[model samples]
Target: MGSIDRYIFRTTLASFALVLVSLTGVIWITQALRGIDLMTSQGQTILTFLGVTSLVIPALVLVISPIALMIAISHTLNKLATDSEIIVMNAAGFSPFRLFRPFIYATCVVAVLVAFIAAYLAPDGMRRIKQWDAEITADVLTNILQPGRFAQLDQNLTIRIRERQPGGLLVGIFIDDRRDPKERVSIVADHGTVVKNEGGSFLILEDGNLERFEIDKRDPALVAFARYGFDMSKFSNQGHDVALGIRERYLWELISPPDDDPVYLQLPGQFRAELHDRFMSPIYPFAFAALTFAFLGAPRTTRQSRNFSIGSSILAVFGLRMAGFACSVMAVKSPFAPIVQYLMLLLAIGVSLWIIIGGIVIEPPASLIESINNANARLLRLFGRPATA
Candidate 1:
């Protein structure tokens, strides 16, 4: 690349990085909040919370990188135009395609990043997150170890512990079971420990008394035991492997799912749509950057600002992306729905490239511009201020 290309590429890269990080961080905090209960209520440490929550960043980056690149390109081009750099380049015989080369380079870089995340990193992260969540659910001690809080394992089962000792002992354990419609059982134990085995998990309580009462009868039967084994297999999610969702599967797996897989047989359209979506995701960055450049890369000598062009570009990008998303959603039901995504993207790239090469200037309609100017004049008059045409 030439020096000018390097300079523009670096500027766009810096802006893109800034916008990507800022947007991703803001969104990550909101998403991470949903997992905070793992630490606050489940007794997980801060590191565990951070580790589990950070896995979603790859997916977020894959979704937001294209939008961030578009914004960065628009910002860079606007800065150049405001300073008349683009006019100088045009006067020096620089074609619009020549000026856009640096942006295309940046788009290629972002496209590769998106492709990697979509094809590998995102699925791996999702799989890891699922495994972590399953492990957390299996660690029953973490859920019930929180003192003074009732942990509901099921709709009719609740457990509370008064305190936890250093030696993996639970003190002052209380269990309420109302799962049976005809009876209710309550148990209080002075000390207990959770034991896991091939059979299942069991809560072994020592020096505890159990009270059972029938729903129809007022009388209760009570029994005391020095040691009691309570089956807790139902409350724990261990030993059962979780099935990976379509999004959690690798690209190869999506392309060739096992014939015996019920999910594949039942929802073949969804699998096909996912495969197409992953392949098409990387091309969006280039399309968006090209569209932005076509709208704002050309030099204009008009005294009026380019706010209309900027807004139009933003609206066009948003509409095209939304259509692509809709296409993906519909592709889950109809096999041919993903074709719309390809058409939308290709059309955008083609139209933008044609406009850039033909040196066409896209401006708002004169009537609309005049209407806006007249409205601004009226508002200024109402405020007793002068308005400039």
Candidate 2:
């Protein structure tokens, strides 16, 4: 690569990284805020909370990277135009396609990243997070049951703890079980720890007294014990499987879902849609780069206004993405939707390539430009400042 190519390549990639990180961080913070209950209500430590929430970053980056590449391209192009570098290069016989080579190189780099995240990293993160969340929820006695508050572990069973100490120790424990119609049981204990083994979850209570009241008898039977094991097998998910959602499936899983998979059988259309979406994810960076270059790559005189070109670039990028989203949604119901989306993307890239290759300078009509100038001048006069023609 020549010096100019390397310079442009480095600049665009640096800008892409900056914009990608900034946007991903901002969006991740918003998403992490929604999971703050993990720490506040679930009594999870900050490390656990952040670790679980940070897994969503790959997914966020999968969506943000294409847009970041477009922004970086636009910034680089504008910088070149501002310094008259593009005009000088053109005068020296550099074609539009030549100027675009470095941008495409940078786009390819970002496209690979987006593809990796979409195909594997994002889904893996989602799957791990779901499993982690299930594990946390399964440890109900330690995580969900808070101190000084009565927790309804089951429909007719309530448990309370006065103080929760380190090492899974629950001090001043109380339990009221009315699950059976023929009997009611109440228990109070000085301390307890939850234990799980192959036999299942058990709450081992120490220094506890149990009272059982039978329906046939008015008086209750009371028994004091030094240690007792209360069955809590129902609260544990160790006996069951964790069902994964469509988004949690990897690309290969989506492509060749097992015939007996329950989620696939129930929502096969979603699986199809998601598979196509992942396939299309990497293509968007190329499409966005094409549109950006088509709008802003042309060399223009200093007298020309680039405001219209910039606006058009934004609109084009947004329109393409919104169309892609709509198609992905419709693909869940209609098989033709994916085809239409492919055609749409191809047409966008085709037209953009045509413009770039043909050196077509995109600009508004002269009458519209004149009207905008007049409006600006009038506003300037109102502000007591003269406007340039």
lDDT of each: 0.89, 0.91
Error of 1 at 210 (Å): 17
Best by TM-score: 2
**What would you estimate as the lDDT of candidate 1?**
0.89
After best superposition, candidate 1 residue 219: deviation in angstroms?
29
- Window of ten residues with lowest summed lDDT in model 2: 37-46
Q: RMSD to the native, candidate 1?
A: 6.5
Candidate 2 to truth, TM: 0.84
Q: Report how far residue 133 has shifted in candidate 1, in Å.
A: 0.9
Error of 2 at 355 (Å): 1.0
After superposition, which runs of candidate 1 have C-alpha atoms over 4 Å from their true positions? 143-160, 163-239, 385-389
Which candidate should be chosen as best, given lDDT against the real structure? Answer: 2
TM-score, cand. 1 vs. native: 0.80
